[model samples]
Target: MANNTSSSRTDAGALVRYYLLRAVVAAAWVAAAFAIGVANPVAAGILLVLYPAWDAFANARDAQANGGVRANIPQALNTAVSAAVALGVLAALRIDPRLVLVLFGVWAVLAGLLQLAIGVRRWRTYGAQWAMVLSGAQSALAGGFFIKSAAAPAMPAIAVVAPYAAFGAFYFLVSAILLAVTTRRRGATA
Candidate 1:
């Protein structure tokens, strides 16, 4: 009974922290995007890169927790690839922001699909399956929008940085809150 209770508390803690991280990261990226301006594709790319890094650690941790095995191999691999692509886009931003954005959009779409595939198929083990699905869908849609925006060279002067900064901000905020709540729950149970 004691062990079970402890395990439950542990799981709750992980859940809360996960959500808090997501919220914070999202909000920060959105803010960065808005502040940096659309022309500053490098900044935007940097912001996007953060997500994959964060996810890599999170996935690795999760894999360890589940069975000391790299269970989320696909997620980890996809995040790595996404990060690399984002970096490559950033490197080319000086030449053309539009090009960077287009690449970013492509990366986002692929990452979203990969995440959705993993989440849908392996959701039975996770408590926040919907959140994963939602995140994946959002990524796909946002990627598409970015691609379209790049295609429309005559479109309004919107800041590309806004999306990234705002996303990071939101991600961090939500993640922090979730972590706090989980901490409290864990404490109570403990």
Candidate 2:
């Protein structure tokens, strides 16, 4: 029982930290997109590539912190997918912005499904994963919207995707808060 409690506490702490970091990164990305991505095409391209690269790095870190990739298959797959998407974005930027949007949309859909699976699995062990589940669902929906936008006549800009990052930031913040609250309550009870 003691070991289980300690493990749970460790997991909770790691998740809280992960969510907070993810939120901060997303917020900064959105700010940068609005402030720089709009004015400079090169900056916009870099931002597009960085978004998925960050996701890959974040997923890898989370998977490693939680358990080995084998134990966290969903996150592991997400990390791989995000990494591939980052490379795809780099290639697509040279061809067309629409391609970048399409790649992001596909990545978002896949990553969101993986996130949903992770949230469901975690919910069995930790009760405060509702925010994560909701975030995953919202992410999938946003991906669909992105796909639709990609088909539009006008070329999509990095600013067009800023709202997705904003929502991501909000969800991560909520998850962090939820985990922090749950940890406090568990500590009090213990």
* Highest-TM-score candidate: 2
Candidate 2: where is the Cα deviation over 4 Å? 153-155
TM-scores of the candidates are 0.67, 0.96
Weakest ten-residue segment in model 1 by summed lDDT: 156-165
**CA lDDT, every prediction?**
0.59, 0.88
lDDT of 2: 0.88
lDDT of 1: 0.59
Error of 2 at 15 (Å): 1.0
**Backbone clashes in each candidate structure, one number apiece?**
49, 0
Instruction: List where candidate 1 sits over 4 angstroms from the true fold.
Output: 1-5, 36-69, 154-158, 164-190
Worst 10 residues of 2 by lDDT: 152-161
